[model samples]
Target: MKNTRIKNIIFDLGDVILNIDVPVASQSFAELSGREQSEILAIFNENEIFRQFETGSMDEAGFRNFIREILEFDDLSDEAIDTAWNSLLLDLPPERVELLKNLGTQYRLFLLSNTSSIHITQVNKILEASTGVKKLQDLFETVFLSYEMGVMKPDPLIYQKVLAQAGIKADETLFLDDNYDNIQAAAKLGIEVIHVQKPTTILEYLKDYAV
Candidate 1:
């Protein structure tokens, strides 16, 4: 049976829908800063620096500076660092945007992403430049960016914030994210969560409850 219990659909921007080459970013950092990718990623994954950056405690420049300091790469210029940082960006599929638009005819679609200013700026540029897809801004009813909102996923507060903003019961919401922890976090609050892997396209998932 269709999960008619679902009323709101929340999406994670990176990896879930939009393809992100996280390894590209890590490789760039390693190449520029002379640190091993594992070491740099260890720092990033351990410190939740990305989460802090997303939650607005650190601006793009500040985050870059912090990383530079951490790696002790005094030789790298700011622009170089920015370039390395942004190398993770990849194209968003036009088909997914169209699917989301179709789903919006029924469900309350929202984007809740743990993204910072640097990444978002790049994303907006890509959306504007895309030829086939509806602009990312136009595909959803609301886009709740973590940097702008000062909250990030896997943190329960962000989920509560999205639920309150959408004015829906947690049981009525379905959250799609690539991160297991983020999915589990939302599940804790009663959201029907999907941990997307591959082949199981979101369109297939939406067909169940889509009107």
Candidate 2:
């Protein structure tokens, strides 16, 4: 039977369920770029490259090429680029994985993420290398990626797409994401939201939903 009150739950990947070390990535990029971390950080917000990659407009190789072009540093290899780009993904706590499995037995659980092919590949490799983490897709009934879908969060279409795919309604769905803009976007569309913030986690925020 479908859960009438909260029939479905959609989760974001980075920082919400998965741990990301932005500082580590920043430092890595700084070293590679020969610039300050602050400068590298600024590029993330101002550069449309992120959107390009996340929306499938750019491939992993193209991204590396763009990085070299923008940085004007052509000597970095593909391995170097993947390492620096993936530095932000730290670890996925076992508790979160366990929680997702538990939640799946009750509400319909879904994973909606803004990610690219290179990053997802690296995330799985990191997890497998460190703790032998299970495949992320296996834990959820559906995995909606921005790169695969060609749409990202904070855009109303993504949320609509998830609902459409799941055959669910916004009011009966709960969405959790680390980014405030994403939370706002879902909430504005009448989806329940938990802004998964620092010092708290998906396990804690969704404590009420855990069976």
Candidate 3:
């Protein structure tokens, strides 16, 4: 079942292996800030601060301060803000864990995600609670995070960095992501890519190789 050409596999985190609902987090923030959910969603999608936070240009404290300033709620505690921000992260299904474990045996697995520290903390907690995994690093050879690398997906540099760091050839690696842009970017770099579209998950896409 193994693909001889692909010696390495790079996975995207949100909506691929882990479930995420942006609207859910927006609704939670809406409740806390007394703003419409749409407004919160719009800000998340359009705001530069969110991207900056993910790329490590803004620290957690700075992000929280910006949240207070924008939401006009200086009294909001850090815990409350974090809860609202992390509410989007739903769960990591057991099936996905099994799939990754099985794939790890036949391929060098890696995780490359555009994410922030706060979300990753919640992701680890969720992973441990659901799959008994203490950390995501246990499931992959190397975990490349945007915050740590100061670069994100769809940027050629990030993909190049991953290939260099892992010592994997582009044509010999397969990249799976829910984002079309990310998939195309990887493809343009000569890496095999699968656009893990909605209604079709990574588990289903790689069913042939799973277990």
Candidate 4:
């Protein structure tokens, strides 16, 4: 049975609902810049530009320029950079879409993602193409994006802001995320959390509630 006390659900975008393959994007960037995939992946993990971009401290043009500079390919076009950056995004499974549709009818559903604008646009496209859902926002009550919010998960302020803006109490909400740090952070704030591990999905975790 569903938890009667839980009034809202906050969902992490990557891995929880949308499938993403980081190494694919790393390979794409490597191919474009003639760099090793490992090097590209390392840059993504360590680069300040990536964090800045996700936090809204950097604009698209600035982020593109930074990518070109880091990749040492000054001639890379905007389309090429965006394509490589968005390559990490995969399809939103139809089953997950249906789960969201069913859950939204019961509890208040919200999407919280530590993602970039370039990726979000591509994700929406993938969601539309895969499930006939026009936009991701249509599946949730509200979408909280790192790039748009200027804050990312693992930060208490982001969760606090979501709770404040949604007018929901932390103890009355449930959060599901693939990242352990994010799960811990939300749990610390008294919001119940489920670590949506690999090979198991929100569909598997909340199958009972979907009906």
Clashes of each: 0, 0, 0, 0
Q: What tens-digit string does per-residue lDDT give for candidate 4 at 55-113?
A: 99888999999898888889999999999889888878899999998998989999999
lDDT on C-alpha atoms for all candidate structures: 0.82, 0.86, 0.91, 0.90
* lDDT tens per residue, model 1, 26-142: 889898877799988987888777778888998877897887778787777878887888899887766677778778888889999988888887787776666454345687888
Winning model by TM-score? 4
Give, for candidate 1, the lowest lDDT window spanning 10 residues: 127-136
Alpha-carbon RMSD to native, per candidate: 2.2, 2.5, 1.5, 1.3
- Positional deviation of 159 in candidate 2, in angstroms? 0.4
For all predicted structures, in order, the TM-scores are 0.88, 0.92, 0.95, 0.96
Model 4 Cα displacement at 99 (Å)?
0.8
Superpose all Cα atoms of candidate 2 onto the true structure and report the RMSD in Å to 1 decimal. 2.5
Deviating ranges (above 4 Å) for candidate 3: none
Identify the runs in model 4 with alpha carbons over 4 angstroms from their true place: none
lDDT of candidate model 4 versus the reference = 0.90
Task: Say what the RMSD of model 1 is.
Answer: 2.2
lDDT of 2 by residue, 52-75 (tens): 999999988899998887777899
Candidate structures ordered by lDDT, highest first: 3, 4, 2, 1
Report residue 185 deviation for candidate 2 (angstroms). 0.7
TM-score order of candidates, top first:
4, 3, 2, 1
